[model samples]
Every structure is written in C-alpha cells, then in structure tokens.
Target: MDRTRFFVRVAAVYALIGAFMGSHMAGGGGLELSAIHAHILVVGWLSMFAFAVYYKLFNIPKNSKLSVIHVWSSFIGVFGLTVGMWLYYTRPIEGMQTFNTIFFIVGGTILLIAFVVFAIMAFVHGKFISEE
Candidate 1:
C-alpha cells in the first residue's frame, strides 16, 4: 500500500483542513473551533507525518499485517475523531445529541487504540530500524 505515501498524503489533507479551520476561526472572531483545530493538526497531520517517516525510515516489510492494521486504524481513527468532534460541538442535527456524544466518545476510544497499536508496532518492528 505504500504506507509512507498514504500517510503523507493524508497528513497533507489534514494540514490543509486544519489551516482552513484556523483561518475561519480567526477571521470570524471566534475560538469555538480551537480545540478541534489543534487536534486536527496534531493528531491528523503531525502524528500521521511522524508515522510516514517511521515507514520511510524503518526496514519494515511492506506486506506486514501490522502495517495494514496501523495504517487503516490511524486513518479511520483520525477521521472519526475529527468528524465526531465537529458533530458533537455543532450538533447540526435536531435531537441527535445522544448519537453525537456516542460518536465522539467512540471515535476517541478508537484513536486511543490506534495509538496503542502504534506503540506495539514500534516494539515489533523496532528490530528493523537498525536494518534501515
């Protein structure tokens, strides 16, 4: 899947979205989006970019199942978390507060699992670092 490329591309998209959100908040004279904006940039862009570099720097096998889990989980986790945050805060729909809350909490939990998987990946693949 060329995880390095995938992560970098997704990270770029997140960076753009975060920037746009930041600008919107600034120009609109409101900081309501501050938490979400920071998280989008940090988790989506920064963390994803770091993972891309991990793939680039390590000698991990391309066909490893761990990489597959890590990548997909990271992608899903980030998207879910960000969108869930948006929905939770905006509540753009009517009488959907329960759904929004559940979505937000689940998204965050998934993201945490992703992080744990990331740590495990490091341990399992750390041996490959020297091979790089």
Candidate 2:
C-alpha cells in the first residue's frame, strides 16, 4: 500500500503543524502548547519520516502483516497522542479529564506496540536491497 509514501506524507503534515505551533509560540503565544508541539515534531514528524526511510531502504516483505500494523498504528498513535495532549492541556471543554488521559495513554501504548513490531520486523526481515 505504498507505506513509504504514506508515512512521508503524514510526516509532512505533522512537520507543518509543529512548525506553525513553534512560530505561534515565538510570536507571543504562551508556552502552554510547547510540550504538545515538541511531541508532534518528534514522534509525529521525525519518527514517521525515519520509518518511511526505513521502508524505502529495506527489504521488508510487501505482504507482511506486521508492516501494515506498524504503519497504521504509527499514524493512529501520532494523531491520538497529539490530539489527546492538546485536549488535556488546553481543557477546551469541561469534565473531560478522564477522557483526555485515557486517550493519551492509549495512544502512547499503541505507539509503543508499533515500535516493538518494528523491532520484530527488523529482526525478521530488515535485509538490505537494491533500488526497486
């Protein structure tokens, strides 16, 4: 499913969001969103871009179910984690602390699982390959 392209595109979106947040903060926006901005840049942009490069340079089997899981979970985890963080920190609405916390934790857990799966894939199929 063109995982490399997919990951890179998603990562680009995260990069823009993170950049905007940084610019906002520089322009006198409070530091309230600083942590969220950092996480989005790191986990969302950097990690995803790295993963995309991995897919581009490695010989992970196209049919591997593990790759699918890792890719999707990475996307979901980033989205959930970033949105969850913003919600929890901003408290845009009332009485949603528990929801926000749960959402953040679940996203982190999913990202962890994706990392574990990536490690497993590296062990199982991270062979070098010629350009396709």
Please list the Cα RMSD from the true structure of every candidate, rounded to 1 decimal place: 1.2, 2.0
Residue 43 of model 1, lDDT score: 96
lDDT of candidate 1 over 1-132, digit per residue (tens): 899999999999999999999999999999998999999999999999999999998878888888888888899889889999989999899899999988888888888888998899888988887852
Q: Which residue runs does candidate 1 get wrong by more than 4 Å? A: none
C-alpha local distance difference test of each model = 0.91, 0.91
Error of 2 at 89 (Å): 1.0
lDDT of 2 by residue, 71-119 (tens): 9999998898999889888988899999998988998888889999988
Q: Return the TM-score for each candidate structure.
A: 0.95, 0.94
> For model 2, what is the error of residue 8's alpha carbon versus the real structure, in angstroms, after optimal superposition?
0.7
Per candidate, the number of residue pairs that clash is 0, 0
Indicate the worst ten consecutive residues by lDDT in candidate 1.
Answer: 123-132
Candidate that scores best on TM-score:
1
Model 2, C-alpha of 18: deviation from truth (Å): 0.1
Candidate 2 Cα deviation (angstroms), residue 54: 0.2
